[model samples]
Target: MSVWPAYAEIRFADYGEDFDPSVERTEMERGVPKQRLLNTDVLQTIEASVQFRSAQAVEDFERWYFIDVKRIGWFSMEHPRTGEPINARFRNGRIGRLQPLNTLFRFAKRDLVIEYVRAPQ
Candidate 1:
């Protein structure tokens, strides 16, 4: 039987610093800091998602997800020919990749809903 790989749905949101940076940009027509949000506001916009990763991925995202792995998901195959268990069979295996953190962050008004579900270790 195939094992239900361990996974996690981490949800994080941040509109940068507590206060908008002094260099707050603006729209072409408005000619001012059009609109922005506080850190808490962003914390509430990011949608929840799941990512299947080895134990290593947990620490990686926890520390560098913002830059390395923006979004989160189960990629079909990370290492296809390393003599390892490849996950290329969409019919039975899994795939991993970044989710929709980009679009989610772009939205100034959205609800944050991250769902983390990992198989018991």
Candidate 2:
């Protein structure tokens, strides 16, 4: 498989209500600070804790990125503890850092936002 960009952003449509201050900080800090989250070109998978609307959106995202979800498998999982579906990025290139399920603030809508932290490097 051709290596793609290491980092990408995924937004879960239904995070609803509960918001994490830390995530908000990271999301907002994408390109502002010297060390920005957007500067995350070394990671392989960036998982967004959230809920998605339909499987079609997931498939679409995979197609857009040229990634095979079936091969990629469950990029993210439905949180067992929380019951919300989790969307994530995986394979290829970066650090292994994940937010705790509890730490994940919910988004409103229905789709999950995920980012690939690293690409085949």
Candidate no. 1 TM-score: 0.19
TM-score between model 2 and native: 0.21
Judged by lDDT against the true structure, how good is candidate 1?
0.31
Q: Pick the candidate with the highest TM-score.
A: 2
Per-residue lDDT of model 1, residues 1-121, tens digit only: 1222234433233211121232434577645546553232221111323442444444444444333332343233222113333222121212234444343332122222322221122
Residues 88-120 of candidate 2 have per-residue lDDT tens digits of: 444442223333332222222213333433322
lDDT of 1 at 58: 47
Model 1, position 66: C-alpha lDDT score = 35
As a whole number from 0 to 100, the lDDT of residue 26 in candidate 2 is: 32
RMSD of each: 18.3, 14.9
| Candidate number achieving the greatest lDDT relative to the actual structure | 2
Indicate the residue-level lDDT of 86 in model 2: 48
